[model samples]
Target: MKLLLILTALVAALAMPTSAMAAAFVVDDPVDGPGVGDPTDCDGGAPPGNCSLRDAIAAANASPEAANSITFQITALSLTAGPLLLTKPNTVIGQERNTTITWAAGAGPALTLEPTLTGTGSTLRRLVFVRTGGGAAGDPILRIQADGTFFDRGQLRNGPGDGAEVTSVAPATTDNVTFAGSTITGNARNGVRGATGARNLAITNTIFFGNGLKPISLEGAANAGAGAPVGLRVGPRQPDGSLPLSGTATTGGTIELYRGNPFSSASPTLGDSFGVGAGAFSRVPPFALAPGEPLATTLTTGGAGTSEFVLVSVPDDIVSPGLTSVRAINTTQLRMRLSEPIDPATVQAGNFSVEMASRPRAIRSVSVDGGGTEILITTAGGWLEGEAGYLQIGAPGSFADAAGNASLVAGRVRVAAGPGDFTPPRLSNVSVTPKKFCPSGVKRCRGPRGTKVTFTTNEEGRLELAAFKGRKQVGNRSFTKDKAGTYTIKFSGKLRAGRLSAGRYKLRFTMEDEVGNISPAATRTIRALGRKRR
Candidate 1:
């Protein structure tokens, strides 16, 4: 009886269907071959056979086993057709230092993990994805819809869209996606985008640069739905759950911490310390995570950060120095009033210059005034009276403020030549030659053989002499003096031949200074006797 029972039990055990064994697919071909004919086949050697990446993915998806793996041994491969869709829980790993996946332009994502599938132990590691073309506006190099997916040590670059886009669909599942030790750069949009229904996303030890918008963007549906919280811990997370604090750092310009979503009406709540030079490991302001709402953090300029913190250098507040007033202290010196104090060391002769229609004036020196808000510019020569001139100060990067912020643009001031030589010249020693002579007992005095007038001035200027007979005819002489102090001018010959007919005559003298200042005219009257029957 015992032998018969053992025989029946053994038969029953053999009748039961056994679980299918998990299989490993090795992709040896680097070409875009056709899809697989038998999804259960993995031993086919190379291209046109079953060992290509596309066929491997298709075989893994079609396999009846719950767990499977796909690995590559090629140095490089191109995905010429559509994206390799992942419909099953599978681990795709690239050979260390030897595997690269390049997607053609306008093609779909390089890899898309379908939302309909559940990936509890799925992992993607040690791979490089170069998106050459064809990713549309909202497309990404990697699209994830699976739960508990892990991406490690990957490089995604040069894509027309985001590096990765993660979304969770209806069944309201919580997709806990973790990405670590990766680099995403030169993408058209965000480095990583968390679309609506995404949840429990974590990023660590990832470097992002040259992204068109934010490095990380969190978006949700427009309606209010219960979505899983998104937490971003930049750097390594400590065991105590608190971020390690570090010293402050500076940036080239203003660094924005968070941005508002253009698609939704909700605004981002940025912390007070969201500007440039924010410390690494600084606590970012908490914002609402609503459905259809979007939030992002942008890194527009270069900054400093550590492995565990987002340390950004503070940008100096640079304001162009404003010119309030420009005055000429003398012909060659100008005093410029500024809106604020400037750095003394930045003031140099090369930084300040004068320009006119003639040419650029040479800057002899530049100095700061006692008030600290004024700049003194001394030219090689005095300014010409009434000439239009421009005083330019602060060349780009040459001049800075007291806080070390450089002036990005040059500052200019328009000025005119100041009033000059207000004082009029003094004239003296006025005398007329060819004195009238009267013969003793003669009835009328006669004009001398010639008439000469002379004068002296204290300033170097043009001198004029006029000789008039009664209110009618006469002669005039003009001359110029090269130096200040004294000058003389004489006029002779015709008081106009017989024109000075034994009568009274008037002599007028005037002088004009170099700066166009005219002195009062000096006049002298004298009687001339008629020439005796010459």
Candidate 2:
């Protein structure tokens, strides 16, 4: 029976069509390159540092020619990125509203997801597409020619053309496109339009506002005979925001909509501990990550032979920590309140992004108060009182609860700046101690305290540290510096992953004054030696 089962599995595997084996590409650089590196290796070629989105996509598109069904683990990406093409299925997955794809006037559509030879579509998550300078653009934000394209948790906003529309006006065989949990607003033309020959286009859990002409127009233009959309499915607004097919009827011509997006509910084990006190925290941020290290090594001294209250995350616990509120304490500083205790070491620029008027603000440093309930962030530029903006957190699945359960979903909060001094604190002579870190079992990379964080501030404020290994935020540690001078504190950042790959990490620091005025930012780089030696 076991042999028969094995043979059945083998037959199923043999019957599967030959597509490109799965691959992950970490796009570290912000610049565009053809990605001359080997498709299988993705080493940034003989000259490294040029392998970014284009390069990764180029390599990913070329992967079907290779032998091994390589599941490449890409670990990093750019934070200001652009118009590109995807020939493969579901090539890039960005956090909703957390990842922005901008297109220049001359560049084609911000992105084009072309279907495969067999006519299968792609799925993209949590991405925002827009035009530069907010003027008339020729192409739609996204041009989907595939048959079953599914895009969730994205925003098609502020464009000169349609927010999301068909690839062609004459309909070159595009249909079965679905858009969910997205915002289509402030565009010059229709929010979502369909051209002739399109069929079964659907959108749900979406918002259509301030768009020109019509919110949704499915018919083909007058001149293009029979170019109108064959059918349009507008689903009902989900109460909890789950994407269940509501079986709504199709309306052929044009439809105006002011529908709203859905919000996810809490997991069964999830509960909020609002207004938590600082004394509840028993251990440093890094030690709490439930990486399954020996409890003896990580067990904090709470009681009876090393604390039974081990401040470690339970592996695989599905608690979704949520951001309850985000408000600026001052022009340069913002504080976030959370439902669960977040691991401080994982709070960094790589995990959070700030956007004002569709542009990102440079993050200097982030501070998590001792209890992990409140997060303080210091951004580079200051804003006036009541300036509108947003904060996108945990986009790369970085921040976690005390039980080590990573926040798989990204969340965003609308924020308005508070009144305070616009000038940020001055920072200088920042440094990280000579130490390296790898995962728990890996002996090749080891150094005491992981790495020490030392810096000087001009005024009384807090010392902040945010560490990132490529685009992945590894860890962060923050402490209050009442009266500032030169101070050397041990950085408790875990270079720990399920073991780590040998690579460089960016160590960022900032000084926030008592009023939350933050310095621009100081950066240092440290390397983590995984299995490979430098």
Candidate 3:
């Protein structure tokens, strides 16, 4: 019964329908709480303003919509109201990177997402959850009892407990979990510890900084235990297919890309602890610590009651290169910096392209400077000074810092005008490429014609697009800039009433600059033809 429910919730939860309406609750107060809170009773919560994180979450829980959102107006909130429990999926979005949600010393985890009939359902964006007091326990900052969740561009730090790292215990196995563009620091134990249950997880563009223990935990109960059959048999693959207890034994865990995460331990038993040294970490059996290497910090050996420590680690550059920063150097060129130096031989001008407002820009050439970490590219006309766009590095296999690993985010990356880019973004060269949107029913076209809109911008900004068919609104999509430039946003022609149908629709583009400047509205028209039944 437990297993079935787990699978059902995980699968259903992953299919978040785009058309489902969402209820939004905005936080007006930063006070943690006055205990008993109810979302539906919006005006009754104590502290009078009627809106708090606890209250907002309560309101979202009662919402029947496919998705609900809780946004904060204030910068910080104390969990004084009590434990935060989410029964339904909700998005807790913060005002900015520094927006914080804090918990008292022994308050337990900052937030708990325990769904009754679903996964630990929620997406937390741009918020920081801090565990204020200490006393190393294994509690995680975010207690993910289930799966099917996303923590994007957020931070989780300062916790002491088994849950020290996000964990899952209810459903023995949870799936479809992702933590992207985020940071986890100053935890007592593992940065991310997986449950014995299926911990199907993915990490992208995440950094683990100054973690008390391993940045990641891969040992199952069997291996993590220090009892007899104690340590994982470590060694290299011998000529006869046998692995001898020595250097380079695949302990069988790959934390492939760990970006600039530094860890240090001061315990002899843990001198050669998990994630002892950063670079790119992978777990293999027994690689001895250097003769004079420090020990007794965070142990990875045989746990406690065990001895003989090994400092198994991989150096930087073993993982693929990633963008650390992007900036425009005057109007003449732009530089995309990488996490590590690359082999100059992989350089190719054709591999890089620029885009503004959702459209691609031309690239005359691209080259890797002597530093090996900077990729300087130029367009025929040089970069537009106020342009807000992004650089599209070559696709997978096009470039590699190390021999085989390709750079991540080769997709579209926003361009940032480094020196002074405060100008309100402007739109130009706007295009509705299919200026006509076609659904599957349109037989006259070579294929079921899908459609997209493209436009260029003078500075980095956000684009909110509203599509209207006849007198009614059909679709709405927001295009967010990575830096600032051109973009080609795909338009799903689905009508507000149902799927796409024969009609003339107008796409309204509203662009907003980084510094709160809104641009003049731009509109494009497209016609959709009915499908030809087979």
What's the count of clashing pairs in each model shown? Answer: 22, 10, 49
| RMSD, every candidate, angstroms | 26.0, 27.9, 28.9
Q: All models: lDDT?
A: 0.59, 0.54, 0.57
lDDT of 1 by residue, 1-534 (tens): 999999999998777554345667887766673453345445554444346777778787877766777787677777776777887875555545646788864367788887544446477877788987656766789988887677888888877788888776675653667677787777788888877666656665566667777666766541122221123333122222222212333332233343343222333334323333433434433432222233334322221111112323222222445567776545676767665556778777877778754568788788885234567788886457555577776456545556554545466767555556556678888777555543133444443445555677887888865566543324555678877665444343333233344567676677767754456668787665554564
TM-score of each model, in listed order: 0.42, 0.36, 0.40
Task: Give the per-residue lDDT of model 3 (tens digit) for 327-420.
Answer: 6654656777665556677778877777753456577778885245567777654445565668776565455653334554557677775345
**The candidate that achieves the highest TM-score relative to the unseen native structure:** 1
Task: List model 2 lDDT by residue over 1-534, tens digit each.
Answer: 999999999999887767534555654544542333334335434255545556566676676632211121333332133456667654545532355555444455666777665535566766676666433464577777776777787788777778777654343556667776677776777777766544666654455567765655656431132122212222111222221111111212221121121111111111111111212121122222222221111111111011011112222333445667677766566777666567787677677888754567888988886246567888875566657689886563456665444555466778766545556778888877675655344555545435566777877888766666544455565689888688887654443233334678776777767655567767788776555466
Alpha carbon lDDT at 78, candidate 2:
28
Winner on lDDT (1 vs 3): 1
lDDT of candidate 1 at residue 129, scale 0 to 100: 88
Alpha carbon deviation, residue 167, candidate 3 (Å): 3.9
Q: What lDDT score is found at residue 217 in candidate 3?
A: 58
